[model samples]
Target: MFGLWAPERPTEAAVRSEIWSLGARHQGRPLEGALAELEADEITSGRAALLRACVAKLRPAKVRR
Candidate 1:
């Protein structure tokens, strides 16, 4: 888990890696949160740190809708 920084920067590979590992732990598990209604159908496969950040906490998708 990460704390809020005064300023945010681009996500790093290490952070992405963390996201992937977290995702793996909860793979196929159902999550209930504010964004719970959104389908978290897949645990992203690449960008380890980014994935980890995402999995650690629900982050906004890199790609825009």
Candidate 2:
């Protein structure tokens, strides 16, 4: 398989940052629900899932504060 065919997985820190930025854009809405709504607007399912995963992983950090 050629390296070119593979999609790169984002680093955890990068994903975390993306989640934070996205949260800021749509404050008060749950991240998972936001992503789901976005997916209905033509975002790829895979991309949505990846973002959801990032949000889920970072959710505990938000709750601890």
Candidate 3:
């Protein structure tokens, strides 16, 4: 739900890449801080939810391998 016309959800790899980019931009800040930056940038709730979902899926405790 993050597109202007297509309205598609990002893939897990896309989400991970975005998170990694955010980390690089923030320079060692926590994920929550990056999320906060996203929120401050006026990210939509749906997009925020997707990012949170990606975080959940990639969390250390949730990863199988």
Candidate 4:
């Protein structure tokens, strides 16, 4: 397995902070489950929208090869 994890991978605390800042609908729910699903690119509901955005925003930008 490649240890290609980016140095700036989003952390749970970052995710929680983003959720609070965005007033995401799923704020009070367990974040681990939601984060798992998001990483899998599951079909998102309204509740997960803000979380999705936060994840995308927090990740380092991909460079075009």
Best model number under lDDT = 3
lDDT of 4 by residue, 16-38 (tens): 67656544545554354456556
> Residue 45: error of model 2 in Å?
9.5
Better of 2 and 4 by TM-score: 2
Ranking by lDDT: 3, 2, 4, 1
Lowest summed lDDT window (length 10), candidate 1: 29-38
Q: Report clashes for each candidate as comma-separated counts.
A: 10, 0, 0, 0
What's the residue-level lDDT of 47 in candidate 4? 40
Model 1 — TM-score against the truth? Answer: 0.30
Runs in model 2 lying further than 4 Å from the true structure:
28-30, 37-65
| Model 3: lowest-lDDT 10 consecutive positions | 29-38
lDDT for model 1: 0.43
What are the root-mean-square deviations of the candidates from the true structure over C-alphas? 10.6, 5.0, 5.1, 12.9
Top candidate on TM-score is: 2
Model 1 vs truth, CA RMSD: 10.6
Error of 3 at 54 (Å): 3.6
Which ranges in model 1 have alpha carbons more than 4 Å from their true place?
A: 1-11, 28-58, 61-65
Candidate 1 lDDT score at position 15: 59
Error of 1 at 59 (Å): 2.0
Candidate 1, 1-65: lDDT as tens digits:
25453334336666555444544555633222212323456533343334334545554458777
Cα deviation of 3 in candidate 2 (Å)? 1.3
* TM-score-best of 2 and 3: 2
- Writing each residue's lDDT as its tens digit, candidate 3 over 6-60 gives 6567787877777777667777553765566656677886677667765665466
Which lDDT tens digits does candidate 2 get at residues 1-65? 77576656767876777776667776754575456555676776556666766766756665464
